[model samples]
Target: MQQAPRPRFGIMTAPMQVGYHDVLRVWREADAIREIEHAWLFDHLMPIGGDPGGPAYEGWTMLSALAAQTQRLRVGLLVTSNRFRPPAMLAKIAATVDVVSGGRLDFGIGAGSRPSHPLARREYEAHGLPFHDAAHAVGSLAEACTVIRRLWTETEPFDFDGKYVQLTGAFCNPKPVQRPYPPILIGGRSASVLRVAAEHADVWNIPGGDLDDVVSRSALLDRYCAEIGRDPASITRSIHLPVSYDQPGVTRDAIAEAIDAGFQHLVLGLAAPYPAGVARWVTDEFIAPSTWN
Candidate 1:
């Protein structure tokens, strides 16, 4: 039998409704804390919660800055919306981040947000980005993954003519510092997205809410991987669980449950207006106790 993947813990600070300095401070603190192995930010052009018109930093640009400031923890956006940028351009941007962070980038991408999410949908219109239907989103995501990977690994310039993407003499100049390329992390819970994940993602992530639902999604992903002749165990299972300062025990229980369900990569989502020493508090209150148990 294949051994299960070892657990890894990380933190995500959603950029919405928060100041840059506050996010930076938390990440800087997490950088020094050994328990925090990775750090992430969400990709959004506008706020999804709190005051709808509140400040929201663009993910990749902020990520590059954070990468320059921090030394130890691996860094990435929890996901980049495939609809937000052209694949080749995204490939270049990600490569630059990997170089900036000395190859610590875990490149996360997905078939944008669900069309039903009003807040997520509004951003597309607000930023003059087109929000396509589900079919287009998924198809484009599949092609985007293929194009981005080739851009990173292929030596010679190449051309691509997929239904959803087109390129000519496309090439990435500064390849990521990580050999071959940085790990690709695909985040989503849809069957179509899972199929894509099975083929491309080194790590697969879903937001945590209903345990049974996520476990079922993981099993579906396993089926997808098997159909492709890939070992389901080869892909790391990542879950993003929201953290509550006043309800650490609740979060800890969720962590324990997710671990029991074979989720090896845990991303704890920290709400903004982070308290002083929040990173250390997370370590003490959640990670250490859960892992020790």
Candidate 2:
């Protein structure tokens, strides 16, 4: 019998529903599970789906805190919105976390947008950043990527006069512990954003959807990669899936479909406050016996 291909597995917390302690506990559980390889946090000022006035941990602060608490497991934002923080500061923070964690941060980024994803918009506007339209958002994000990459690897400060982001005498100290910097995972489904991911990202994350939906987007990404003379295989493929332990079959089907479609990583999007029993069951029962070996 031909064995199924098993991809890497990950978990992402409910950014809106959980407290700091609950989030840390989720990480602790993930650390204990050898089958789970990565853990992620949503980078938003407030809950993605809840009240804009609710409590939600900041992505970078939680990243640093998680790094300090856990011994294993890669950590990152489902993606830090380029609109929320400037590229240089995000780079500095990522580097610092990498240094503190002995290099275990995944630098996930995205061009922030969404009608329901108003939390990111609110964060930006509150901070005085005008919420840019999709095209403009991606334009600034594309430049932000260049800015971030150069700052991470460049030893000397240099001027970055990007149309949207401008900086002078900027340099990152305590360079990332991961050589060439931590894995960069760019997330989104837009043409402009996909192009940016192809040109620079080490991994490209497609938002969760049905098998056909994700596969189509991945194919488009491959096309984008090819147009630029880069092999599509050069970029790793991943998806953020909504996992409902109540329906084990749904979770199973999602994983199978994703693997069939060439995605090599899966991050379970758990409900807020860490459904501990359901999570542990999903990993140990459904996930472990899948033969990721």
Candidate 3:
């Protein structure tokens, strides 16, 4: 039997409670490391973990800057909330980043934050955006995916009459550097979202911690893909595992488990106040040990 491909590792520096220079410093460092395959930022208008009043840099704006600053690693928001921007506008912004990075953009997106997370939910109202019900959010996301893909691939200007979104004479000029378009990585665990991923995503990502829960979620995604007559193995399985600065051993174990669970794409999330050489430290502690054949 053919051996499974080795898991590829990346880093996510959440742009919360951190300064612009600090984040730029980390991304500059990670850019030189061959072991780090991609870099990511989370999409949030406010601090979700640190002090509520602390600084939170907008994701897409910062991402464009980072794309200009880095050369190798693929870059994107860990998962952009569809509710944050209209689909056509977002498609244009993403295409610009893809061009800036010379085609290194991974379009990670989702059906916005869940209602259960009060911290994440508050951002919508604060930003003068509507916070709709979960069913509406999921339905809108599915349609957003369709509209965005068409905006990227369709040559001529077209109109979209989606239930949650509508566009007239929508067209993207100076298309993305990537042929067809940048890879779509949909991040979510809901059954409805998984069904959307089954139809649209090139990659499917979920947060790690609950291995049993994620394993079952991945299985559900496979079933959804099957229901649509798409190959279950076609969608790459990605997991976001948080890094432990003090306990590298614990992180190593999580990496080992996630790899065993068949997660081919691993994004190691780094917490704020990142230590010196954190990227290299991650490779030394978690990636190298877990990659042993």
Using TM-score as the measure, the top candidate is 3
Task: Write the residue-wise lDDT of candidate 3 on 32-128 in tens digits.
Answer: 9988899999999998986999999999999999999999999999999999999999999999999999999999999999988999999999999
> Which is the better candidate, 1 or 3, if ranked by TM-score?
3
TM of each candidate vs. truth: 0.98, 0.93, 0.99
Candidate 1: the clashing residue pairs are none
Q: How many residue pairs clash per model?
A: 0, 0, 0
Worst-scoring 10-residue span by lDDT in model 2 = 284-293
Q: Lowest summed lDDT over 10 consecutive residues: which window, candidate 3?
A: 284-293
lDDT of 2 at 101: 83
Q: Please, what are the lDDT tens digits per residue for candidate 1 over residues 1-293?
A: 98655678999999988889999999999999998999999999999999998999999999999999999999999999999999999999999999999999999999998989999999999989999999999999999999999999999999999999999999998999998899999999999999999999999999999999999999999999999899998999999999989988899889999999999899999998999999999999988887676
Model 1 bad stretches (over 4 Å): 1-4
Residue 117 in candidate 2, Cα distance off native in Å: 4.1
The parts of candidate 2 lying over 4 Å away from their true place are 1-6, 115-120, 277-279
Global lDDT of each candidate: 0.95, 0.83, 0.94
Q: lDDT winner among the candidates?
A: 1
